[model samples]
Target: MERYMSLLSPGDQPPALLGHEDIQAKLRKWITRRASGSEVSNSALIISLWGTEGAGKKTQLAHLGHYFNEPMLFVDMTKVPEEEREGPDALDNVFREAAIQQALPVLCGFLLQEDSEAMRNRKRELLDRLKTMSGIVFVLSEQPCQPIDLRSRIDLELEIPPLEGEKRSDAWRTLAAAYEVDESVDWGILASRFVFSPGQMSNAMRTARTLSEWRQEEGKSGPIRWSDMVEACYKQLNHHLDAKAKRLTPKKRWEDLVLPEAQTKKLRHACNHIQYKHTVYGLWGFDKKLSYGTGVSLLFSGPPGTGKTMAAEVVAKELDMEIYKIDLSQIISKYIGETEKNLREIFDEAEKSCAILFFDEADALFGKRSEVKDSHDKNANTEVAFLLQKIEEYGEYRLWRRTICKT
Candidate 1:
């Protein structure tokens, strides 16, 4: 059995849930209504909590049990014994067990997998069991449940959004207090530098404490310094974009880029946009007026080897951010929607890393939309449109470098 899957009684302490007050309030309301039997129409209430990994979906489920004040059974579907999962009465048995204990059944791993006959049968079994079972069933997923049959059965679909801005800073403060981190540490700086989820924040603090202990053993005395916490934060990030993009360490600074005075000024202006974005958006009230297109998007068009790439590096170095050169061959897929999916992953990872994205030879992907004569043409245009949308939605720096050939 997976260690994550287990039965917990009401006496177990609920995990500390941070930075999701809206979700907590919704869960509380739902549980209260169900408990009073006033809104009790369905035999079973299926609630799906979906978000990126480490966004505290499981923590929210634990919170639900605390609110419901009942026993809770947590099951990781991927870890269930094959014999039991394949068996016809397996789900029936599990639900029966939950019923016997009067526990809320919380199921994890509802991601879309291959639609095989066995998978279809499993979905059918789960649906039937859900229709017959009573009380609340919580489904945890990395993404929203996409299967129609299973999706329709979900009563409430709540997204545990990533902690951002002040909420993220607040989470850092809360975790720092719990871990007894140095009160003098600038949590706002840490929060600004790292776009970490609450779970990631906790893990970073744990790692920071471990580092501090090692320092004590080595006779190097000090509290958990800001540097230790920063290193820990970097260690917690799993870079999923390596497969799709190449990370470029920025070494070139402004002096290294030999450009015309006008071009150099333009580059400096772009860097300024990124540097003072928070001030301009938050303090200047631009964020309230503008809902999108807040990110800095710059186009570097010059002859090949005229320092287009170097200019990008200089910008990244100026902003003190990591730079990634997106691999067009790896990102543009022949299959419809695959390109968009790949872009989404790249954008998501870039956001977490707070890195500047550099798209070299951008004409191929961002060129004028081809006239639609067939489905392929239409799909290509759609892919470009989707890329543009993601670029606008991305709240960071995106630099596109295009070669301008002399005619």
Candidate 2:
């Protein structure tokens, strides 16, 4: 089989590739791994670069656009209207020109925007069609949407998380070099505290500089302090989560609550898990032994308003993080499986935010299974089972459930 480099233009006047070095290196490694000894087939190699919006995915791809010559069109799906992108013929229309040139298709935005049933079906069809193409296909999406049976169409896939570790630290230093940062400020601490992308970090720096000037004495700011940068980072993070779940800033603490010594001690232990997670899981190396990150979930069972909810708030206060209450009844719908889907979406977001999830009236959903009298009973039982699985799958979340009935 030819090298993965074979997919690029062979002409002397090859187009220019513009993404970052790491991404380009990752792509090269993926291609090398695939082209090592695999048999050549009519099937195309579909690579999906997935990440959240504004995480530099589309920009990186666009930069690489100059490298691909004729037949390999780098389509920016965002330019396509929401209606056109979701239509059934979206894929066929984009690929028609390439198809006529007998060139491989590089379909973008299979999951870049809000997804619908029609878009999902079209994406599924596109994956099937890629199987018969004789060249490599590159797909750019926020999240990869692979068809069940057509999963083989994907040769390699990559997901970009928030700019982390050295990359994040580098971004901070880059900002500090240009800004009036004080010697007291620690770039490493700020980088560790905020899992921000390059775009977010840039915005945060701009915000910090603006805030520094606003609070400046006689319009003259002292060297940008650590406090200013962190404050800006919090501002960026706080406003984003409100769109997903209710943002809670708890004033309550353990000292404010009157509970039994035993109960209070248990609550203290929950806070310990959240506090020591980075150290135990990351620094102490216990994270490797565990399948998932250390997540501690507690079921606050008792009467209504008997400080059950308050305990969760106290823990959130202890951790200095926010708590979000999601009513189980509100998430449960008449439609079958909708309840499970809603729960999954909530848990997924909570996993990332590291916020305390206090699901009030959980017994309504997590109650004991009943004998199957009808399909409704069976579906309810299935939902309960899925809830259990999802709880285990949420590796990096702290969950708190309250119930009226003791189970």
Candidate 3:
């Protein structure tokens, strides 16, 4: 073990993978099969690496480049000028440059926000050329474009999930060891509370260290404070949740909460469900019993300032996630069918975020229904019923840490 650790030293070799064993193995196998004449997985060479913004596509590609001892060409498609991105010749030139540079595993990022068929077709052209000329190709997108963008030509599709459980812990440990920070830092707490990707964690460490250094004089080498790490982790995930809802940093704890003991206990248990649902449902084989509604959806009923919002924040803080108060004005619509559409957009975003979804003023959505005598009444009932069904069905998509906080 000591010898292996020594070999892992950055001086001896490039950075160790730490947690991406499966990705490394698949990437290496594909590179080998593509290089050699050996029959491969349907002779497919185009691989798509996609996830959220900071889910570590570029970093993973770097690791793959290091593993294969090859140069990588990273192209952020968003940076491609609007005129250049629209034209086929621009992309064609970029591919010619990558080939001339003898770059392997070209990483290109495409944002669905600027989604255009011309852009997608240009990407397709590059992908086909790369498969024939380059070592491998990686297409990164904000959404799941594996089937649509890459189509059936995907030799390997690596969707880099946000680091959770042991992977998160491994990331903390790996960066901590590299930084040589105090070993006493609570990595388990960080792992539990932050749904950071490997790249985000790397940025968090750098930010933490810089903050620590700025707080003290040089050569003193003060420890990276726990608060610094917490703040840094929070900042890394700040940009995504702003449009849909406001992000909260809970200054309150269970001690600060003033709810009745029974209610508090129920809230605590619900938070636990968010933290360890995978263990109870998957490891203990409890998932075999029931199908839908594995997520904990509870109604926190009380008057205003009854600690409902704070409890949501506490759960998010305790579980190392962000809390977003869904904007009710945008969600609850007067127009028919638009309510469901808005709710779907919010839920869809929340599913990816894995944050505590605090739907405040939710009584507006869930009200006592009378006999449906009119179209308005029927539409209201339908909207309420649709939300309930979607909330119940969120569990089918592996939302282990997604807690639905209703107020």
Candidate 4:
């Protein structure tokens, strides 16, 4: 308890001692708040740091965390659970995590409290402060942020600028100290060969150290070579990038496609449009911007097993995106207006990863509108109109529409 008390003190912190020229302003601001007796505010603290590989963000964060003395929670946004993803309300998921950390527990605590009205109101006020107390420092590696609500919440954004000339020299010096490499090794030559993040650099150093000890135990006298460091860093970088791609596990490949030659060519062309990023809608004259018209819509009017779904998978694989086959039977409901809600969620979730929306039984949903005979008919027509609107707005992507005798 005594050790924890020093965390709240207004003394000069470790970050202020760092000789790095760029971090001085941030350091001053942090110390000034502490001196003023104000709790370090986390309300508007959305700091986003980004840069090319080996720009040294993780190193900077380590220094800053030591200065703050508060636990810095580095959330890898790229690794969100599937259930927390976009299907229903993603905002709810954010709230759920926040609540788990007692970020807004005071609100719930009031209901459970057996105190009188006056005491309960005072407790409620204390809870208000709790909402602002659980500050976060989330670090997203390379995750694609699709939902607007999620993007809007991020506050302060900083990128680790690309190192050149003297900055590169300084980075190498830092690496040397942390790595404990031989003085004979050429820093300039070694720095030029590798593209690594601070996290990768540290891991590589730790790995080299471990390897060196193992070799020493075997009575070997060779220094840790640059080749070994490169191989280790390469493996770590590959693992990180591959994990990002794994979020959307590809189900099928191009070979699984078994459509007619003509249909296959058209499907392949559509995939090319997405892959090469061809601007067919913009007539290819303009730079690859989508024209502001009805999006590239296509109708795959054919029998089942003719490779409509398989073609969709090829498009997903080519573009490096996800494919979500919509089960219309489950989505389409007997209750009025519920069908539209389900359809909206389907489109919304599909839009997050720019997923290929494969409506398996196309004719069932895209059937011709019936006459205005009864309430059920009118409701059914309304659902059809909504689906048509969503499909139209669903931009240039592989949309497979399977059919059977045209209903």
> How does each model score on lDDT?
0.78, 0.65, 0.64, 0.50
Question: Which candidate comes out best when scored by lDDT?
Answer: 1
Candidate 2 residue-wise lDDT, 1-407, digit = tens: 11111222223343122224578667656565665647556677777778775566644544344334333455665465555455345455555656665554555566534456676566666567665555677777777554444445577677756664455666678766778987876665555445676667778888989888887966765977766776677667633344446766688977789998998898887777765565565456674687753466788887776888778788877665657877777888889989888887887676556456777778778768999999999999999998878777665444556556456
Query: Ten residues in a row with the worst lDDT in model 2?
Result: 1-10
The model with the greater TM-score, 2 or 4, is 2
lDDT of 2 at 360: 70
Q: Stretches of candidate 3 above 4 Å error?
A: 1-13, 38-69, 73-107, 110-164, 180-189, 214-222, 238-260, 271-295, 302-331, 345-355, 393-407
The digit string of per-residue lDDT tens for model 3 on 1-407 reads: 11111111112244545577677677777667676865543332677777776666666666666666666656666566666554445455456556666664344555422447765666566555545543456667766652365565556666767655566777788888767466556776576555576777888899988877877775656788776787677667644556767766666677777878898887778777766665665456675786767777766666556666777766666655666777565678788999998888777766656566777677677777768999999999999899888888764222112224466
The number of clashing residue pairs in each candidate reads: 0, 3, 2, 5
TM-score of each: 0.72, 0.57, 0.68, 0.41
lDDT of 2: 0.65
- Candidate 4 local lDDT, 1-407, one digit each (tens): 12111121213243211124476357436544654555555452434454554455544655555555433333332354445433334324444444454331111101212356664443344333333444543333332222333334444445555553234435556765756565555444333334344445556667777776677789975676554454454445432222112233456777777667887787676666554432332224342343433334556766666666666666667655545566566678899999898877666654443345666666666668999899988998999999878877765453647576546
Query: How high a TM-score does candidate 4 get?
Result: 0.41
